[model samples]
Target: MIIDEQWIYCPVCSNKTRIKVRYNAELKNFPLFCPKCKQENLIDAKGFQIIVIKEPDAKTQSR
Candidate 1:
């Protein structure tokens, strides 16, 4: 499905973004990136919810 916008932002960036959805051949996963912070995000096409709030990853949580 084609979308009007094509990028998205990290949760810390107010979740305001419009990222492109693409397949990663290495991980076999669909990944999105934050335009503002340039952070990479993983969003499952089949199960991910729109306007979803992302939790900090293990690395970020440790900080």
Candidate 2:
């Protein structure tokens, strides 16, 4: 059986991160730290698709 693997890229700087995921791997609200950009972001990954979770601005949010 052959397993497929893919590299995860940073959504902020669009650089390759140090994370690797398998073809069948799944993640929700995962905290990913990018060494290239040095930014921490939350991501949801399934299969080979990665979606970055955006945070709302404090000033724009209703108090």
Candidate 3:
């Protein structure tokens, strides 16, 4: 498992953030998270790159 450099939206702040795909050796599933938001995101290590969809004008949204 490897960490991929991917960008996604932060749900809390509605801001763009960098996400990473990490392989969890101890867990059965892969662990994911938003670097900026610090939110836990679940993922499949063997699956393709995950795409995070954001709402319209998400960039302008405030907390």
Candidate 4:
């Protein structure tokens, strides 16, 4: 199997993150957590860009 990887940066702190993609997987908007800033970021794998989804609220996080 061929695996593809993409490097993503954290918008809040500019932390580098690596994500692996499978050949058959669909590339779409996904949520990622930044370890340094502790924030959820939206990523667009198809466009190779980071998109702003929404800030997670305390209530949603608790669940």
Candidate 5:
């Protein structure tokens, strides 16, 4: 049996994250948390390619 492993990278910091992906893994609308950046980013990943999901900021209630 062969095992394929890949490291997920933080788009913001461009660093390897603690998350790892296998060969038969797929992710969509996933929230990736990076320790180095200390932030969460939405992303879609497949194979070794990752695309960052851009989310709009919520509107704040006016006082």
Candidate 6:
């Protein structure tokens, strides 16, 4: 079992975050929190690629 870490850019704030992905867990969608924008971002790992899924209602400005 090989585990790989990939950097995903947040679509809301363009912040880069790292996510750990496993070979068997490729079909699952991972949730990532952006510290800069304070938004919950989704990471989609399919076809050996990283895709960032942003929620329209999850965007918040930093105080």
The prediction achieving the highest TM-score against the true structure is 2
TM-scores for all candidates: the values are 0.36, 0.85, 0.30, 0.50, 0.79, 0.48
lDDT of 5 by residue, 1-63 (tens): 665987998999989999999877899999999999799999998876789998766675454
RMSD of 4: 6.2
lDDT of 1: 0.50
Expressed as tens digits, the lDDT of each residue in 7-63 for candidate 4 is 667777888755554434454568877877887777655545456666577887974
lDDT of each: 0.50, 0.92, 0.47, 0.64, 0.88, 0.64
- Per residue, candidate 1 scores C-alpha lDDT tens digits across 1-63 of 744333334555767667543332122244666766877766544212334435566876753
Record all residue pairs in model 3 with backbone atoms less than 3 Å apart, i.e. clashing: none
Q: How much RMSD separates candidate 2 from the native structure?
A: 1.9
User: Clashing residue pairs in candidate 4, if any?
Assistant: none
lDDT of 5 at 31: 94
Per-residue alpha-carbon lDDT of candidate 3 for residues 1-63, written as tens digits (9 for 90 to 100): 565434444545656656443333222333445666677544433233443433347788888
Considering only N, C-alpha and C atoms within 3 Å, which residue pairs clash in candidate 2? Answer: none
Please, what's the RMSD in Å of model 1?
6.7
Task: Give the CA lDDT, 0 to 100, for residue 11 in model 5.
Answer: 95
**lDDT for each residue of candidate 2 in 1-63, tens digit (9 for 90 to 100):** 675998998988989999999889999999999998789999999988999999898989996
TM-score for candidate 3: 0.30
User: Clash totals for all models, in order?
Assistant: 7, 0, 0, 0, 0, 0
**Candidate 2 Cα errors over 4 Å, as ranges:** 1-3
Candidate 1 positional error at 11, Å: 2.9
List candidate 4 stretches off by more than 4 Å. Answer: 1-4, 18-26, 54-63
Instruction: In angstroms, give how far residue 10 of model 6 lies from its true place.
Output: 1.0
Report clash pairs, candidate 1.
Answer: 6-18, 7-18, 7-19, 8-17, 8-18, 8-19, 9-17
User: Against the hidden true structure, what lDDT does model 4 obtain?
Assistant: 0.64
Candidate 1 local Cα displacement, residue 39, angstroms:
0.6
